[model samples]
Target: MVFKCQEDSFLKQFKTTIVSCDFATLDWVADDDNRNNGETRQLRGFNVICEDTILFPEGGGQPCDYGTINGHQVRSVQRKGSTAVHFVESPGSFEEGSEVQQQLDWSRRLDHMQQHSGQHLITALFDREFKYDTTSWNLGQSVSHIQLSTPHLISRESLDLIERQANDLIREGREVSVVLVDPATALEFQDARAPRGLPKDHEGLARVVRIAGIESNMCCGTHVTNLSQLQCIKLLYAEKVKTNVHVHFVVGERALRKLGEVFQREQQLTAALKGGASQHLELVQKLQQNVKSTRKSFQLLLKDFATAEAERLEELPKAQRPKYFALHRRDGIEVDFINTLLRNAPEDILYFLTVSEGVAAGSSAKGHMVLRGDPAVVQEMGPKFLELLEGKGNGKENNFQGKINNLAKIEECTALLEAHYKPKKAATAVEPASAS
Candidate 1:
């Protein structure tokens, strides 16, 4: 590698430096995974070396450093030779010659630091207390998890003990130590666990993070120097995958906030039940049943509502043939609406009717709409039908839907269909929004 540490040093918080370097090169190629999508690749951004960066290159299954550099965000940081190559995510303004100020967003950096630190502590606790080796780890956007190489050996009781130990360590507030040891010196510490297929020892310098009395590992990522930096560590969930058990967790501010929000919502639910908190679960089940019943009732109500609507259409003069009907169920949909449409049309006449669940923007909605008429009726009316509702629909079949963007043309839809399809002076049947 180009830039190897010669001595042990820690980055002071929020450090900034300016570097003037000649642009190495730039190119656009298919992103490796897809090999079809073109993504810009600038492998030499590592040329601008800064003193302090919280962005860790991809290590420990966590993603690489991503934040603004000068103004261009460094998408991913990779090690090319001895230099850390920063993958520029967005092209803003940079050149090999143009001086750029490299910086990291400390808040974002610190959050990752806390989580990574928590992971170290938790992993250490699990290994020591339950003898489980962390085989894989992934720190993601909302949660971080690690899989134990031998999951079957870990019982629920064992997991509880690990959680107790990890959180207790967080509460105790230990000083996490990052140490540099020569590869030979690293061998002296027999208990230290390092990832497989990684260098256990280096010639001159190696990076190892020690949770004071808890855990120690060879690491290249940024982390909180003190265990106290992680305000809280929340055990979100755990599940077994293959031979390994994956433990999901959250840390720091988010951990405490999520805990409080979940607790408070459960409390509110229990209060609504008016019984003990134990009854809250049963009460939730009852509420779900009530919603189901209400849905069935709403469908029956829609039949009556549509019946009255079709009744009003019956009152219209015959020339105003109600050849088109676009009924929408804005709040509650009814199955009867679709069934009624299929049953009631005159054999010789053409009619288009639909019941959509929700409006598309302000116009059409999603669901079924069927139109059957002279092929000419649709040829003249389909475009206008979608236009009035401010929606989009196309079909040469008896129907097509993905309509209901707007409801403005419903009346005109009735007017045009009566004039063209029914071709009767008094067949006008204007529909109205269901009052039910």
Candidate 2:
């Protein structure tokens, strides 16, 4: 199949006749188990084949072009053995041999071209300057990355050198050319970098992209005709990935976009933090330290309050004392509060205590409980208490503790515990059996 995009990268619109059209479905498994039975979803669409097309299918580390065909949205484009299949969303299929207008999303196409060409230039420079070869690349939506075949990480100095040289070439406005070279005559080009060699099934000639006085390589993806079209190249950062270093970069309009986004964030931080861009990080660190110190002080205060609350319960009049002493705190009370209370609690006092960590009523809660009066009562009530709060806990002897999901149910759970442990009414005194 002849690809119009390869011949003319700037072709935004073209007229083509539909070679074939059929209903098709794209299927893929979701990353998460969100579906019943974990089945892959099928997206219904139409697979269209055109006599001549400007849409570049996804290949050679570049994404497919997104556009419209006959006013229908083209979702994706894929190459299947020399055939460019255009996946389009349409209610009815286009009839075979029908003429249609194809339009390429120029902004997207230009972005891909800039990134792909920038990668080629960077790859060539790395090889020339450092003997590092590019093994793979990814043309991402927002940024692009090149994987260099090296065990050691790339140094910042080396990256800066390569980036400077690449932008210099862009400023020089060197012409980029694509040529079809016969395999037998490919040896004439000494600067061409073809590590994998030509495919066995590759027809008569291999398509080679050459940057003037720089490097030439076998590439099928689209590119800008001139280096200046790239505007500029910025190497963002590099990281070691297994045996290679993946270098991230942005080119042309994307570099401008990245800069705009960063400056906007800087403005926001300046306004909110009342600090200059250079002082933002230092101020944030200081604020974090202050928060830590304040949190420690608050925790100590809660502990002291918990100790006083336990003492008040102990001082209650004997007649006013309830069968079970229960305390429910809506504020973020820690488990240590319960432990402090238990440490000072009298042996006969059966205690039900809860601390809600969540601020909202329906959020999760955590607590600890101790039943010290009766061994049988502790054993029976421990599991029931956890069940009421929708929690799981473990215990040995008279203590149990766990986390619960329903914070709103804490009051109801405590009430149930009070009722369960309420002393049975004194049995009516039996009158002496004098009548007998």
Model 1, poorest ten-residue lDDT window?
1-10
lDDT of 2 by residue, 280-369 (tens): 999899999999999888678767776776676678666655566666555564777777777775666667666675444434655433
Model 1 lDDT vs. the true structure? 0.61
Model 2 worst lDDT window (10 residues): 427-436
TM-score of 1: 0.64
Model 2 has a clash total of 0
State TM-scores per candidate: 0.64, 0.79
